[model samples]
Target: MGFTDFFSDVWDTFSHPSPDADAGGKASTNTPSSGTDEESGDEKDVNKDDAKDGEDSEQGHKPSGDDDEAEEEEEEETVDPKDELEEECRNSQGCAQPKHHFDECQERVTGQIESDGKAKEDCVEEFFHLAHCVTSCAAPKLFAQLK
Candidate 1:
């Protein structure tokens, strides 16, 4: 996604959560709406659905794992650095690790980028610049344990 879309998503997720989200996505419609004014029957139905959802969560809410699958699919849709890195390492033997453990490295790198208040690409570029010391190292002792 472009930076605009990505940030818009972040803002949307942060700014507006379901009212009952913190309450485990449950709300009691029978407890009465805060409305001093009359609510339509359709509005009442929506409230009832929200209440029912809350009740379902309180009882037993087993996620279908679709969220997890969807997130995985979204990540796959993004340009993967591992693929690029692997392709870059193809010509040289022992120049890079047999495998790239991106998850652990990415977590740390992303955290640092956020904490340092640097652009994501800037941090990533710096990481690659430093990481090349290991990837292209001649000495086994100095070799980056990339896995």
Candidate 2:
């Protein structure tokens, strides 16, 4: 593929997510139940275990008050690194979009490149800088890909 296509694909990977990832790379909870759920048998076994273990003591069972704190810990544990990074990048891009639009708005931006008594190399440099500036405003990570 050409440079532009490759660059676009890279940006897409960052903005969206890799299909190979299962919900932020977490293992799916698809338990294969041979289509026959033995709820009665399972409940009977669980009741026996609970009775044998006794209410106050079996193993590492945290109490209700401590469970509130544990729930908070579980919530923190569920954070997805990829999702966090992508959202952070998207927020930065959102903040930059309007400014980038102003910097690279069509009429003004074109005039910026061709007009003025700027040399060809200078004009090209300025154009690239303009492009970079605009992308940085909306998507700084995308701007980095161009370099």
Which has the greatest lDDT? Answer: 1
Query: Which pairs in model 2 have colliding backbones?
Result: 96-137
lDDT score at residue 115, model 2, on the 0-100 scale:
80
* CA displacement after TM-score superposition, residue 100 of candidate 1 (Å): 21
Instruction: Give a tens-digit lDDT track for model 2, residues 38-78.
Output: 34666779988888888767667766798698778888555
Model 2's alpha-carbon lDDT is 0.58
Candidate 1's residue-wise lDDT over 1-147, tens digit each?
Answer: 998999999999999876665366565565555665767688889989989899766655767788988888778565755555545564345433322433346666678778986535434554564467445543342234333
The residue ranges of model 2 lying beyond 4 angstroms of the native Cα positions read 1-36, 39-47, 58-147
Q: Count of backbone clashes for each model?
A: 1, 1
Lowest summed lDDT across 10 adjacent residues in model 2 is found at 117-126
**RMSD (Cα, Å) of model 2:** 20.3
The per-model lDDT (C-alpha) reads 0.60, 0.58
